[model samples]
Target: MQGPHSPAPPVDVQPASWRDLSSIRELEKLCFGRDAWPWIDTLAALTFPQTVRLKAVSDEFVVGFIFGDQRRLKRTGWIASIGVHPDYRRRGIGRTLLVACEDLLGMPRVRLSLRGSNDAALRLYQQAGYVRIDTWKRYYRDGEDAIIMEKVR
Candidate 1:
């Protein structure tokens, strides 16, 4: 008899370095399309000091990634960006990267901003204990308002 299918292997989240710039750039393009960060921004995220960068690897592939900026004076950590390849979405990769980055940031509060139209990301952040704190008008190049969210520990 055929046995029930086994669960897929859990994705591994690890620190991301400059060596991951190319892969992270590709993932950003795939996940954010025109809103994807430019190569320079992606490079900075991977190489900047006081930033927490993490990648979710599945089967040796960079399936998802996140970048968090730590501001010690303000005691706030800002999640600058997070994305998962379309094929890898909904498998907890985003959440995993998010949690890993948050842990590494070790801030009293963490914040992020996303397009108002991005319902999926909104739900994910909300489910992970974030709450809407503010909104920026015309935040994107295309004029989509950015919904800012915050999570305080």
Candidate 2:
């Protein structure tokens, strides 16, 4: 049995495999809506050895996921994608996944792009020490500008 004040069960973060493609695809659709990646892209991200893919799992179900691509020659890394299942938001799952991905990338700086209008995501990144570095005009398919943010370690 667990006490009321007992800590919540620990979430396991591990490298994602091709077997998780469907779960990741579903989660991307839920978190990103129209911006979700196509199935091919999601599959590639999972199987590409150079890419950093991490999933937050509890009871063998993926609750959150993140992907990072490192460019060692440029000393930078890009957060390819991040998404948390709707039921898992606001519980630090996204943050945990992001941190783990960054650690795996081992780059001098980590960069990510988010819709300028996404206040919740912006707040999360800001709180995680990411600073807005630039903005791209009409960056999204829907023509929404993208705010580029960076965190230097």
Candidate 3:
């Protein structure tokens, strides 16, 4: 029986690399609007050492992507960014990608920062057992606050 964290049966999750730059860029723009990372930043995320990037594939399309920043010295992994294609949200892609990244990070704690008004993201993170531990004022480029949430093992 599939519990809450399972990916939709047909979804295939795999490690993502620089080859996915174009699709990842489109998805970032779709999910974050003005806050989407620039092409350079997106490229770096996929190629940077110590970063864990993954893509969710369905119907031969890259439907979701997630990447994390791992700090071995701090024993903490920051979920740098995550997004799902608009038509693919809430089908367990987000949660599954999150869990998969967390495992690959293999750190004692995982944290993520999200815009304060992102209700769907807040819900997903909360359901994944993250608790808000801090907030950064005017953290986003448009001046939206960033809610910092963390999950500790």
TM-score of the candidate numbered 1? 0.94
- Superposed on all Cα atoms, the candidates' RMSDs to the truth, in angstroms, are 2.5, 2.1, 4.7
Predicted candidate 3 versus true structure: per-residue lDDT over 1-153, tens digit per residue: 769997565888999999999999999999988889889999999999999999999877999999999999999999999999998887999999999999999999999999899999999999999999999999988888999999997
How does each model score on TM-score?
A: 0.94, 0.93, 0.93
Off by over 4 Å in 3: 1-9
Tens digits of per-residue lDDT for model 2, 31-146: 98888999999999998877999899977789899999988889999999998888778889988988888899999899999998999889989998899999999999989999
Candidate 1 lDDT over residue span 26-77, tens digit each: 9988888888888998899999899998999988899999999999999999
**lDDT ranking from best candidate downward:** 3, 1, 2
Among all candidates shown, the one with the greatest TM-score: 1
CA lDDT scores, all candidates in order: 0.91, 0.90, 0.94
For model 1 the local lDDT of residue 87 reads 85
Task: State the displacement of the C-alpha of residue 13, model 1, in Å, after optimal TM-score superposition.
Answer: 0.6
